[model samples]
Target: MALAVEERRETVAAGAARDRFRWWGPVGVAVFAGVLRLWDLPYPNAFVFDETYYPKDAWSLLQQGYEAVWPDNANELILGVPQVIPLSQEGAFVAHPPLGKWAIAVGERFWGLHPFGWRIVVAVLGALSVLILARIGRRLFRSTLLGCVAALLLSVDGLQFVMSRVGLLDGVSAFFVLAAFGCLLVDRDRTRELLRAARAEGGRAGDELRLGGRPWRVAAGVLLGAACAVKWNGLQVLAVFTVLTLLWDRAGRRAAGAWRPWRSMLRRDLWPAALSMVGSALVVYVLSWSGWFASDGGYGRHWADGRAGLSPERTPLVDVPLPQVSMSWVPAPLRSLWHYHAQMYDFNTGLSSPHTYQSNPWSWLVQGRPVSMYWEQVPDGQRGCASADGCASQILALGTPFLWWTACFALAYVLYRWFFRRDWRSGAILAGVAGIYLPWFQYQHRTTFSFYMVLLVPFLCLAVTQMLGAMLGPAGCPPRRRRWGAAGAGLIVLAIVGCFAYFHPLYTAEVIPMSEWRDRMWFTSWI
Candidate 1:
């Protein structure tokens, strides 16, 4: 009997090992994302959407610190061909910070500033996001295979795939957001193990167990900070993640038999975590703008007015004081830039344009209204040439319909586990959604688009696959049920892949007839 029990235990252990990373892994996810992003990359050959702004800014950033306008007809020149360095320093008004565009500039600088070269930065970042999501999911689900599956879904999603192929700021922001979330996951695991060990070793309240001495957590902080530096929306992740980390620390304290885990962390871990994550991020952010600070022609470069070289020195310029912001120490250009940011902030929150593609937070997960990035009327299928059949072709700004739909139901499961069972996994998923989604509610009146959800996609994919894996059951589940669940979920995945393929043309802006484009526009909002 004893021998039989031991053999059975060994069999279960082997099964668990099989599920860990038997097949799916980060490399597989990278390949999947790369295939989706790199195939037919130079499709329309023209810059799409706001590409008119970003790719040029990126190029300029590589050459100069600030955004400078290209020649009047430069758009046509920059479209399909690599060109010489543009020397004109005419100012261009831009909304977000420079880091994301600078990253894109790096690719354009190296690859000669064409569509693919400009977009290469976003594609690489998107690929990295897949790897990070896979690793994060592995840690979260405690199963590496499931983690890979999570990344696979994001790798193929229309929104994610399209964004990765374009020179957009959103995808870069998404990369940092996902990376930060992964870092927080590492912090959680490290802290948990430390908490467990301290209890095991009979450590006292004053005894510092050095729980989760995690460099990864610091990495997360830096990433989140970078996210913020990319766009202010990242501040939501910073605020939400900071609060969540503190709460986790509190829970860790209570679990570790500390009289005051929160207090202990306050005295020891909190400041260090802040400095590590926040400090590292601040340095990176400032460094991202090193070009901006170093150059005299930058938008806000005149702030210091020569008080301190490179540093925007604070100056008191209120002799004829206009407003309360008359700081003596802050420099002129810096102060002007500060005011510019204030105006930008108010503008961001106050705008209420009824954009055709603008979607509310509620519909994002289900993809109710996908933005249409590009469209054209193709005559009766000259490309495919079906005699009488008309095709509606397009680059629809939509996700894989079935994949996003699955996330809807999966998100519901996240809520169920978070509110009912207090599962930390559920909480973690919810925190991501909260960081991305909840803030949008206040901005509902603003001109927000569904594409903004791109940064939040990795976490949503993880949660969806996590719920799917749970439905598949563990190795201990009844054999018949486990087999049936795995089969069903596998079929669902197969269907999602099919949907991705069907939508691939639109995502990549491949030329199809107008009728086919109409067909892809499942809703009028998509048009």
Candidate 2:
């Protein structure tokens, strides 16, 4: 009797310990990633790549409440040429939305127009994304260790690391998307738990059940709206995940023994789900444009006035009427806003201007044609270089080759699990990856780059971590086999870390001998 009592106490203690293992693991990894990203962040000391556009635009937004056109020498002034670039009253025609620039503006407002000021917010977002991913992985896989592994992989991914250190919109958009997806995962489990409880309470099959106030799903919609506010590409994720959540609802109802679960879900859940996700997202998206709406000097603010006296034209191809609207009751600014969006839409779809570093979406998964965001040829004596040969300093936006390459296999495995095993988790991951990636295929003829793939990296890391969990074997596997499998997975993760270290110089613009830089390039395309 005493042995039985002791054993019960030990089991209870173990369960309590497991329950207590929260936050610290994910928090620790995030801090580590933050330190790496923040270390010497202001180096190279100039706007790199599209930094020429975004940081400047952010500063304009901060000072003017909207983007303002700058003088021809604005770059020189911002880079400390002893002159202030005065903002012109004319509005600047920017391609992307204002939310991302607003995020960068927060950092610029605090730190001035220096490199650190513009890049800091992105680094912070990137670090928080690590924490969110860790928690999401724990929920999905039901293992804290595997969750940390997922976070670790993402923390070390080269593309994410580089993007974190730059003032860019994609990182911000990616963070919001990841956050929304995590919230949806929480909603999924919460709904299922409610359904299970209902079943236990003697609820009849096919009975309409109302699980009230799905706060997580509502939150997901708001985050997705924020994602869309950053870039239109987020619309794809919003569409895919909205459908995914509805399917999850149907599956949950079925699992709870509902007869005709699909019909029950339609009757009991469809309107609420749509209103929570789509309606909330639409509201947030409109709110995100408040800065533009408040500023009369924003680009295309007078577009409606310009079109007020013009007649609609017939299209040459189809004889369809060209879109024209005259809403006398609506405020002029709102009509102008609608016209502005239409013009922006046309600009986005027609962007085929070639860029030096453009890569097909097909090559993004393989790390082909990584963009060199910053480069400086430092002579032997300059920039702390002691080597006899001249040095190459660069910030290369490339993924850790080992991690990305291995993730391809992991993605294939996820597809197998999604199709054959009907694993919802695998399907969720694939949906994210597909939503971010497949749209790029439609724009193959346009100028796109592999750096855009940063949005897909979090999902890839999740898929890889899922595969690692499988490699650890089931609970029923022999202890020796499980041990060996765990060791192999650990070694693979370590190898990926090692690969990241080897390429660290290129990712961070560290001064290294030309030969060493060439050795790290590994491919002519990378050079």
Candidate 3:
């Protein structure tokens, strides 16, 4: 009896050790990634790419509570040239929503409008995303090592690294989408556990399982809302995840031995899930426009007020008549807001302008065309380049080649597992990829860039890590086989890391000899 008790104690101790490792391992990887993202963040010292629009708009939002137009030389003024352009009170007509600019403003709020000031929040978001991915991987795969591998892969990915370093909306949107997905995963597990407990308590089959107060699902709703507020693309994720959550509820009921699992899930779970996920998300999305609502000078804030003079036929797409019903009780701002949304929708759909760096959605997975966010040719003796040939400094939004190529194969493997093996984890990962990727196909004729693929990279890494777990084989495999599998996976990961290093100069604006820059380009499309 003593021997048996001692063995049990040893097992408990071993489990405790594993739990501790799981908690700390991801934290360590996050710290490493954070250092890389945060180090020398102000190096470029200029507005890179769309930073010209976003950072300035962020400053306007901070100062005026709405995005205001600036003087003609606003870019030069903000970039610290001699010009003294002031932001006008008139609202700036921006294509995207205000939440992402608001997020950027948070950083500029603390620090002045320098490079680091506008970009700090994105960098922080990027680093935190690594931690979130690691934790999500742990929960999805039930292995801390795989979790760390996912985190490591994200930390070294060039596109992720560049998006994090720059002030961009997509990185912020990616973070919230990832966080929402993670929360839904937690909700799935919690709902299953609760159902299991209810079954053990002698509940009759087909009875309603009142798994009440799903805070995780509510959290997911809020995050998804934040994502939509950042970019409309997040709505795709919201739709896919809502269906996924309901399906999971059905699966949970079936596992709990409910006599009519689908019916019980629909009757018991549908409304509550909808209210928590869709209803809450709607509330959050509306609230995100508070800045626009609060400011009268905002663009289109008075769009409806002017309709009194216009005829119903004057409206291009939708016929609008003067308000007859005394919506006098209704706020004028809300009426104006409705009209503004129609115009914004038209703008978004009609945008088909060609861009030099625009890439087709089909080639996004293979990194066919990388958008150059910033570039400069330094003289022979400038910016620490002493070479006889002029040096090239650039910030190219590209993914590490080995990692992306490997993920392509892993994604195929995930499709097989999702269809044939009926793996829920594979389904979950693919759902994220589909939500972010498939919608781009609809807009294929419009200008899109590879950097938008930043949203899909986390899911790709997860898929790759899942395949790596499969490569490691079943838990009962021979030690020799496990060793070989580990060696093979490690070699692939190491190769990806090496590729990241080779492309580091391009991701950052590191001035390198022209020959070295050419060597890193690999393809003319990258230039």
> Model 2: runs farther than 4 Å from truth?
1-16, 81-83, 205-207, 306-325
lDDT of 1 by residue, 382-408 (tens): 766463555544677788999888888
> Model 1's lDDT to the true fold?
0.78
Of candidates 3 and 1, the better by lDDT: 3
lDDT for model 3, on a 0 to 1 scale? 0.89
- TM-score of each prediction: 0.88, 0.95, 0.94
For residues 76-122, what per-residue lDDT tens digits would candidate 2 score against the true structure? Answer: 78888545667898998888888999999999999999899999999
Residues forming the 10-long window of minimal summed lDDT in candidate 2: 309-318
TM-score for candidate 3: 0.94
Assess the local accuracy of residue 295 in candidate 2 as a C-alpha lDDT between 0 and 100. Answer: 82
Give the candidates in order of TM-score, highest first: 2, 3, 1
| TM-score for candidate 2 | 0.95
When 1 and 3 are scored with TM-score, the better candidate is 3
